[model samples]
Target: MSQNSGTEILRYTAFSADPAGGNPAGVVLDASGLDAAAMLAVAAELGYSESAFLTGRNEPGHDGPPAVREYTIRYFSPKAEVPFCGHATVAAALALAERDGPGDLVFRTSAGPVPVTVAREGGELRATLTSVAPEVMDIAPDDLAEALAALDWPAGDLDPALPPRIAYAGARHLVVAAATRERLADLDYDFARLEALMHRLDLTTLQLVWRSSSTVFHVRDPFPVGGVVEDPATGAAAAAFGAYARALGLVPDTATLTLHQGEDLGRPGTLTVELRSDDVRVRVSGTGTRIEG
Candidate 1:
């Protein structure tokens, strides 16, 4: 725990090695003294999609390396605290790996306990987080219609194979698939209207997707509920989308999917989603790099 008034706030971009090619996240390695207001202030000042704060870590009970290092983590967006955030989690894991050698880590988040594993891959540090049990639920017809209207997308524009639904891994997201890549790229929507609709649905972001192949996808996230127009890379949405795909029988029970996001924003990043045949949890993996000022 760091009690100093000037706690170091590290900036790291997740899912990409290049600083300008991924979603940037503010990571506070130690945030013991900062209260909720202070955390919110720091996130608001940074104005990123989300920031991660490491409140404290438990002592190593056993001998070598301990089984897993448990830590308390909190995620805050610019406007409010979120239940879980994927990009910030990756950033925080890489930051920890820099100090302590990579292995297994458990983060006690507001939503639940999330397990992350960090390892060096091809000279770059990569982190994989196992999401909590995922679930897919049906969306009300009226709500879906309202959301489509807000995005100015007609019902016919949606993919008949992929139906609209609400999916949750750590956070809630409305999964809507676009019929074509062009439709997904052109994202000019009423911010206020979409924000209101998302708030009413208790959604974190609208996961807009276009399937390029059976296992390859392009995704965009409209995050007006978080005070952002769009998120360059959204890990939570990716996890939910994985659950959505599995629920819809779009992919086999055990499969790995690739999600390409942030390309339209010129900050391209790749997120790998893996689904296991025995586990209901989703695994999201990506590489992260520190952004030096």
Candidate 2:
């Protein structure tokens, strides 16, 4: 761990090679000595959308680094702890890759075990994380209406092809698609109402999306529950959206989709999502860069 000002917090940006782009995440490679409260305090001080802490690792003989590369990871937002966070996972994997070289790593998260593979893509390092078995469930009519009201969006503004549903990969998210790009661009919501709704529904973010092509989509995540107005780039929500799209038959059994996110926020990043015919789990890949202080 690199200590600065008596604290070891590493900053990285996921889904983009440029430090100015993508979603920034704080990563603590070694947090074994810190408790949950201390970890949360660090995350809050960083004020990123999410922060990752490597609380434990299975190392043989107390070696320099684990040969198996299995780690116990925890994610925390400025407000509370979350089951999983994709951007932070990617950031952490890239951080480890810089030290341990590119390879496979497994993270034992609160939700489940997430396997990540890191490799050099072109001039930058990229990480692909295979999410836990995803599930898509119907949204209650009342809940859907309430969510729409919170966003001040009418039912008519929704895309008929993409129905509203609740999807879970590592964390729960409400997937809602707009009929037009213009509608998706205008995002001004009632933070308190949305936060309350998300708390009641146990949601991390609202995956607001618009399809620009058969395989290209634009997405935005409202994360009032995380104490962030909006997530610049949300990898967890992208994975859930992939499951939602596949369940709706919007994509083929095996396909690749590109998600363009954070453009409106000026931190544009690209996320590549892959779905296999035999595997129910979704794979999301993106490059990450170390954020300079």
Candidate 3:
């Protein structure tokens, strides 16, 4: 642990290098002494969508980047803890790059081990996280109805191409594509009702989306479970959605997808998702900027 035992909370915005573009994440570079309660308190105080805590460091893996680069990371929402978080992961990576000079960083999370790489690409400090093995499941009709009611969205508004399904890369998210961009932009829902449905289904967030093209999409994530109304740019959900697209054969085996988010909230951010031909792991990339005090 660093000599300064007091928790050091570093603010970072993920998905976009610009501080105002991506989702802001509070990062505690060294969380050696803080307990669970303390971490949660810090997260709540910061009031960002989520915050990341790096508990410690470790030796790098065989296929991993460095010889001695390992970190145990935890994420907290305003209300509670989550199994995993994408934007926080990206934010943490950029923060690490600022200190250790950007290479490969491995994070040991409750969900699993996630590998991240940060490098300068075209004057942009891009960070990519390889998600845990992905999985997808069908949404039951009854559950879909309940979810639709919660969102106050009629069943007819859903896109026929992308049916309601639950996708998981690092965390589980409900994937629901809208028929039109206009429908996607209008995002008002019963927060309480959605929260109840999410709790019942063990969903981390609702991946509300609209496909702009074969490789581009617009997304919004409702994170009631984490006690947030919406996430500007969610890495976890993007990773999961990438898997969903691949499983449905919507995109080629190896393809890159762009997600435009937070526009409706006026905090527009972009996330790039890549699906490899040989691997089930989805790679989500974004730029993060340090949050100045």
Candidate 4:
């Protein structure tokens, strides 16, 4: 066993019920003593792209049900701290569910308030997170061209239907819809260039997508900013993409969007995005399993 001093680390893969699939993240149940530097060190040691540090709790004798859990949660990558993370959120929710049973959970993040719900459906336990209000914007032509060049992809490979836009729900991501599955599958990009651009634009990841159907899409996220080359499955980007589809009238008023991700990485996972007619906060659900220590 390796000698290290810190909080107990639990490993789990989010968005997939199997341990082999989805995005793996380190979960720290309580990070009371750990500071920012300590958290970063722990995440670097784990090196699972992103790790969650859970700090604080609801006041002892507070209001009924506790709408606000008062968590000073932080997300650390191998290099630095991020404002928010999607797959890590799912992992955190499932971890909470294992101990507290299936119910509603509130996570107070650096970005904003995130509400997650867990329920048992058959043998699988599904966790759904309701994102903050979402918004979308146009991508600058020069930026788009540079991004395409870095990916070694031609502009013709882009989908005309979905187009390109910068989307934001809990965090910001640039949504670029590819014309074909082949275009989406091949993901070799200039890491340094993309990272520089993302840093300049204040982007979390590039939400590269391909529309399989009106209600089905395939997604791959490039997260150079987080010090990860690619994210196997990204729940926060999904929420932002869902909002993009709805706002642009790409899908029906009430629809179930199935996202197939991580196939190219050999860690296939599924994410279900539900868009409601009345509510703007998108619901993203998926299954996760604990990774053996």
Tens-digit per-residue lDDT, 244-280, candidate 4: 9998999986888999999999999999999999998
Please list all clashing residue pairs in model 2, or write none if there are none.
none
What's the true lDDT of residue 52 in model 4? 89
Q: What total of clashing residue pairs does each candidate reach?
A: 0, 0, 0, 0
lDDT of 2 by residue, 186-279 (tens): 9999999999999999999999999999999999999999999999889898899889999999999799999999999999999999999999
Best candidate (score: lDDT): 2
TM-score per candidate = 0.97, 0.96, 0.95, 0.96
Which residue pairs overlap in candidate 1's backbone? none
Off by over 4 Å in 4: 1-4, 62-70
Candidate closer to the true structure by lDDT (higher is better), 1 or 3: 1
Q: Candidate 3, residues 1-293: lDDT per residue as tens digits? A: 11223677889899876778889999998897888999999999888889999988875568875663789999999999888999999999988898879898889999999999999988778999999999999999999999999888998999999988999998899999999998898889899999999999999999999999989999999998888899999999999999999999999999999999988887889999999999999999988788687
Pairing residues by index, what is the TM-score of model 3? 0.95
Give the per-residue Cα lDDT of candidate 3 at 190: 94
> Model 3 lDDT vs. the true structure?
0.90
